[model samples]
Target: MLKYLMLVVVFVGSSWVHPMHVSVCEINFNQKDHSLEFTHHIFIDDLEKSFRQSFNKPYLDINNPDVGKTTDELVAAYMKKHFKVTVNGKSALPKYLGHEVENDAIYTYMELDGVKTLSSIRIFNDVLTEVYDDQVNLVHVEIGEDISSMKLTPQRKIDELKF
Candidate 1:
């Protein structure tokens, strides 16, 4: 009995036990408009889990059409708090442009205008890290011809993308 229990524990602790918890964020610096556009893609299931923890609603479902406005507000508030970016020591408050559900993922859009230059960019993406231990947030930044990417984890919440 003890051997069987130990085997089960070992199997559960393996890589197969880890769930796929990841979010992707794409940022493009529009030279013509002199602004930055942000798009975040997150899995619906992972987002629902995080929302449930934040709102203390165990059965919360963000995909439900009946709770449209409420869910939008929740999502906006959460994104505002968890995901952030600053360029050249100046913080850009993302203008929430709402979100869309495409297949199994929810894609949120935001843009920050009046960004004239970027010597350095600091990204702080905590997304669903608060809810999942192995959560990974991938950030991709594009500036003219130069493009860079970084991985943000719970331990490393912030990262810089240099041109």
Candidate 2:
């Protein structure tokens, strides 16, 4: 079901004003590198709407360059505010590497270093929930050889998994 949903969202996410308000996040712990990887998939239109509404700016163009920041930087800041990850009860701040724009959606990448072990993982993702009441964020966490998934909505923004 998750794979089917992901396929649908990726194929049709470029269109403007879709009924579904959703985002996808993938977290992986790299044992060799001792780091945590985060990848977020979000619609371009919905992200722009979030920026405009949150910043109170009428004309915020994510595709075009702004004097304040590049599109990826702007998005990274937003993600830093809306998305959080806690490992073993300690919160981590990830470094935003960059983003990729495909069709009507953008894929953002972030990484946290020096995370050698993981006993418990908690994710708080409220991306675009303020703009859309029905917003849903799907999170997939990978630790060692196991993968765990969770669905986040406006009413519930956080989920925890124990290793």
Candidate 3:
């Protein structure tokens, strides 16, 4: 009986382990032109591989900038177009995680999700830099803070289904 119970525990624990991550971001709202620029930094245990894979998405041109924007700016625009805040299919926004005001830049910690699926569309906002080239506003996103092990989502498991 004890042997069976021990086996069950091991199986459950091993299978339940998941990859969890922490995200840090900053939003620079230039009230002057009604534009918002954001910078996000993510820190995870395995950054090189995970960052590239997780953030890997198709590039999008919101309005076709004449001179093209930075990679970060482009990413920001793409996010705004595709991402939305929703809790159970309702509108939700990023909540304050923390903040730091430097001499020239004010870094804000706007966390999208403490717990979320890898494929989930959890955060979005306009990348002003994609618009006007002059005095262009921009949003930057970085993924690295801490990624821990947790239970995997049903969808993730299904997606990972192997033959």
Candidate 4:
């Protein structure tokens, strides 16, 4: 009995642990500006890996002086391919603003201008899904006082929120 218990402990201790694969996105409708502000929070390591794979680059250093511009370009292109938004059933491509690295995560900003009214929003966020099978993307939308949230996974990549 003691041998079996020891074996169980060893097996549990030696088991491989998978890293957490998740990204958070926040979309807010700015009534005064008539625009939809988008912010995405992603792990820096994961983003670098995805960028490397997508761009076929050997290395991507986030701290390099010249890397900021290249990183922004890569991020914008990646977002354009992986993330999308439709307001009131009309497809609107967001304008890439910029990105900032905070601690271990990267925050990407974008905007969809001329959004006068928002009745429904369709979001398709597949960031890192191609690389990580267990990737999960969480999205939160704030339209005035009303709010909506959705969880996107590999199987279900798109979700429509009605406000």
The deviation in Å at residue 10 for candidate 1 is: 27
lDDT by residue (119-145, candidate 1, tens digit) is 788999999998888988888787876
TM-score of each: 0.83, 0.88, 0.26, 0.82
lDDT by residue for model 3 (1-163), tens: 4333533443334344513332223333333433334444322222222223444523322233223464335344444443334433335454444434332222344444433322222333222222212211212222233222212221221111111
What order do you get sorting by TM-score, best first? Answer: 2, 1, 4, 3
Superior candidate under lDDT, 3 versus 4: 4
lDDT of each: 0.79, 0.85, 0.32, 0.82
| Candidate 1: regions farther than 4 A off | 1-18, 65-69
Worst 10 residues of 2 by lDDT: 9-18
Question: 2 or 4: which has the higher TM-score?
Answer: 2
Candidate 4, run of 10 with poorest lDDT? 9-18
Candidate 4 RMSD computed on C-alpha atoms after optimal superposition onto the true structure: 9.7
Cα-based lDDT at residue 3, candidate 3: 30
Per-residue lDDT of 110-150 in model 2, one digit per residue for the tens? 99999888888889999999899999899888777677889
**Residue-pair clash count for candidate 3:** 12
- Give the local distance difference test score of model 4: 0.82
The parts of candidate 4 lying over 4 Å away from their true place are: 1-18, 56-58, 65-69
